[model samples]
Target: MTNKPMVSIVCTSYNHGDYIAEAIDSFLMQKTNFEFEILIYDDASTDQSPRVIKQYENNYPSLIKPIYQTQNQYSKGVRVEMFNHNRASGKYIAVCEGDDYWTDPYKLQKQVDYMERHPACSMTVHAADRVLSDKKKVLSRVRPEERNAIFSVERVIEGGGDLIATNSMVYSKEKVKVLAPFYLNAVVGDYPLVILAALHGTVDYLDENMSAYRVGVKGSWTERELATSLKRINHYHDMEKMFDEINEYTEYRYNSALEKAKLGYRFSLLLEQGRFREAKHGEYRKIYLELGAKKRVLLEMKRYFPNVTESIRKARWKLIH
Candidate 1:
């Protein structure tokens, strides 16, 4: 690992002390022909996360570079992962969070070889195991496609965040720089980054499951934003504005697909907020029709007995979290 790094591995840590060692060890274990540097940004973690990072930095000073933030940047509206991109001195950027670990030792080796051969591909992502964070139970999941393929911009806009996992992302540094300014203000960074990167060039899909996605983790965007009623309303609004920005950026070329994605988010918001009438009619009716018969019936039940539904929802959240 003495030569200049061909890839920069980006990671963020916030109270992930328990899992940071696995993540760091995973990065160190990658068997790549070309050297790669790990850039970990510690968001002033009020936990043992920083200590783990320091130990790794000491052991591999040349490879493990980190920033110990004195203040939390995300709370100040900073798109936190950009910390790695800004300091990136490599041709490609790869991402893995402190709570997520790569399973394959040859992951970087395999991806970089493919990207080196295909200049047309700005990014490449693989399938990953989506596991319950606390239980460590692997949920049956499939993503992108069943085989290797080219992921297009339209497909990216339509699928949003579900199509790609951040831990599985490896993209050209040059392509991402052009998109940074456009998505800097967006509430969520990774989703828009994928969309904008797809606009630059194709995204190669690798069928291999190379990483683990720890779902329902503490301080995760899903838990902090999408798991509640009030937060989800604002979250959906953020989603709406992001779609509008992308549509305009693409000159309405992908308006049809993007509109459908936005409508789904709107439907989710209305249903969760007990606005049954809005969710069952108008633009949302399309999603209602698309749902299975059982789900439609359940939605009616929840609509009529909102108090019961609310109680049930609260119980579920408490049980899970």
Candidate 2:
């Protein structure tokens, strides 16, 4: 009787036919003695995704179990589908969506070992490399910023670790069950789960880049609109609204507001670019003013004093680029 931890790998696929096989192959290569079951949920894919799932299930019946849906659940929502599929399992959940793949065969083993040793650790996340679709190879290793390697919530928040990479996280069954209710309505489903896990127990940073996240060129959540101010402003506003719903501390709100302000500053570039309508520009200006009070004193000072803002902006430009 093997006493290894049972790891349930959940792979959710929509239209990622091109990437699904490699996703499954990553799991199939796992060298662990633990009972690992791969649950592949095809979310009513119209592409070759169904065929890919069938192929993998046929090849590795011992490790793979494919769940097929007959109709489009797009209206019912992706989050709902994910929660339902995940709730059925009682073991620890390690997520690697069809678009991403685990690179290290010992990824599960390493995490499980750590969690067992450190009973306080609820979740463990490693770093991941980003790959382009056409290239079919890694474009660049998306290394974690110096901050995430350490385990501090403030550092995590300031260093943008709140955007915890989904592929890198390994969730205990208890955490999975706790998060199932919250996952349903969260616009950005992953954030609340991370926050909830942090509340319950510590989330460890595994420092190594052990996974590959395929960044599709035409995906809905790509960073292509970095050049567009209105888009940036809207994105920040959406994040601000999401943050408001968290019932977290004022410090959280303060940090979130600062982030919103920085985004608004970038968004101001659109006004400079003459891309905004007069009314829209006025609204944008109002947003910056509202965010100004919540941000740092320096930013508020910059609001009242343009010459100082210009000098600081020039210094920032020189330093950053």
lDDT for 110 in candidate 2 is: 93
User: Model 2 — which ten-residue stretch has the worst lDDT?
Assistant: 218-227
Question: In model 1, how large is the Cα lDDT of residue 203?
Answer: 86
Q: Top TM-score: which candidate number?
A: 1
Superposed model 2: Cα runs more than 4 Å off: 1-5, 81-85, 88-90, 145-150, 161-163, 180-183, 217-235, 248-321
lDDT per residue as tens, model 2, 1-321: 243338888877777787888888898898885777888887788889999899888888766788888875654655643643454453577888787888899999898888888777777888888776646567676555544453554434333423467788887777545553433545555555665566567878887888887765443243344424466566555555545554343335446543644455445555444444441455466654554555535554554675786687667534432
Could you give candidate 1's per-residue lDDT for residues 65-135 as a string of tens digits?
99999899988888788788899888999998899999999999999999999998899999998887767
lDDT of 1: 0.86
Clashes of each: 0, 0
Clashes in predicted model 1: 0
Local distance difference test scores for all models: 0.86, 0.65
